[model samples]
Target: MNKKILGLVVSPGEAEKKVNTLIDMIPCALKEVSQNTEEWQVQTIVDSLTGSAESINEIFQKINAHTKKNAWDVTIGITDLPIFHEGKVVNADINEKNDVILISLPSLGWKLKKNVIKQLIIKMALTISESDNDSNNKRSPSFINIFPRNYKSVRLKIKETDSFHTRFILGSKIKGYMRILTGMTFINNPLNMLQTLSGVLAIGFTTGAFCMAFTTMWQLSYLFNGWRLLLASVSSILGMLAWITVSHNLWEVPSKKNRKKFRKLYNLTTLSTLMSSILIFYFILFLLFLLLSVTLLPPSFLGQTLGIKEGIGFTRYLDMHGLLLL
Candidate 1:
């Protein structure tokens, strides 16, 4: 019996995480998926493949080169970058001849990508094993993947079988857009970015303290209802997102190299990532202020300023002061 080696080349961050977690299960999975008697050995490596926006052909070639260099029977390249073909997002690219597969992590969305990847890997193995379609080999969608929002929006039904490769494309435009956006946001990891920026944290804390110290600030918080405060919070977040977008020039302008749709998608991704970070920051600030308002400030002092005669619980105090202070 011949032994086959499988190499996984994954994008550096979250893409790597998704694939690495499968290292133990994949070889055993391939054994079960493959009808052949060969034992499978799986190895993993990290690579970004290419930084270019248009990297489909480049990725395919890189997968081949990596396989040759590493001497593996099959190579699967997982990238966080969105793969676009014919104005649509591509979920997977499989070259049966070369025994190579390229998976777009962002197309697989955030939560259920790990399981989806496992299923795809098994299916791709089955595809590579067959020269023609077998009706009995039809794979059903996992129950976990039925929900588009919670799982992936990438449906594996559309297969473009060709001399070179088979493509799995995302079905709906709206679902594809959202899946790519959320996946991109997940890969970019804005909350981690927020944690590293000391200046932002310092400014946020200082401003929060300044607002909390003022009696007038508390009165203003008292005057504004929850709806008004929520509006203000949303407005401030939007303003910050806009400012960051313009100031950093994160918006992708169309060029000879990149298409208008890609630029639009990328710009939306940048905003989404930034908005996630800012919203997380806002929530953390609210929680922190809520904790402080209950512990540090006296209920009697708050009621006197708000002109409330009777007993109001800490929830009301938190609702009025905590987020408004931020």
Candidate 2:
């Protein structure tokens, strides 16, 4: 029988782009690995994330139904949504009977994302093609290496028969925390702060530019030691982060259905995202403050305010203290 594969992408942007690109490569790679004589065909379906899939089993059922309706032997689903199995963030799900692969894009995280996903797809394709079995024999060594050495790809029997459904997840909680943190941060996208925080940046730069002309500001910047400046920067960033989180109501309030640990992860991801964005904001503001201070602050005035003689001492003081204060 001719084997047909369907690539279903459930999210826009990176998920759609990467999965579509990888779809073109699947046929060729499958032929090389499985070496089947039957004609190989791949079809792609682009769809928005399904909000109805509240559980992994629900997602599996949806993918399975789609695959069966399309008459595809195998369907590979890539989604940006976070999927959980047995209280852990499920990175990938494979149903042996349905021949469907569901991947949680965020669970893969941002680091080495494309490579990790590509490897997972190829490995799963090979597995479903019957390259290996439920025994200890004939294993793909490279597949095990995709996750960290400490990580385990646990397989559980979904039926009374010999077939097994496998899930790739971070077994260790610490590693899981790091993985979810980076993944959620990637999804939140720190770079978008450039556009979203335009008003905040404008007001801050405007006020700072005006402050640069004042001798009090100059003297304060000069008086502030390294530790004091560092403390100010930290406090400023934290304050901004706190304000944004509270004002926008971004904090995830746990519900009765929410898992305790997962809820913590959710809140942590939010905090991490906010912290990254605020740091970026602070960095840009620091550059603006530095430019205004150096260009507008005069050597004579700054030297007198700083109580340092003109020339090298004044220049050194000004340059060293150019660091932004709170």
TM-score of each: 0.82, 0.81
Candidate 2, residue 171: Cα displacement in angstroms equals: 4.0
Clashing pairs in 1: none
Worst 10 residues of 2 by lDDT: 132-141
What is the C-alpha local distance difference test score of each model? 0.71, 0.67
Q: Name the regions of candidate 1 deviating beyond 4 angstroms.
A: 51-55, 130-162, 197-199, 313-316, 322-326
Highest TM-score: which candidate? Answer: 1
What's the CA error at residue 189 for candidate 1, in Å?
A: 2.3
Question: Could you tell me the TM-score of candidate 1?
Answer: 0.82
- In model 2, residue pairs whose N, Cα or C atoms come closer than 3 Å (at least 3 residues apart or on different chains), thus clashing, are none
Report per-prediction Cα RMSD to one decimal: 4.4, 4.0
Compose the digit string of candidate 1's lDDT tens values, residues 279-298. Answer: 78777777766776677678
Q: Evaluated with lDDT, which candidate comes out highest?
A: 1
- The list of candidate 2 runs beyond 4 A from truth reads 1-3, 21-23, 31-41, 47-54, 83-89, 131-141, 158-163, 296-301, 310-325
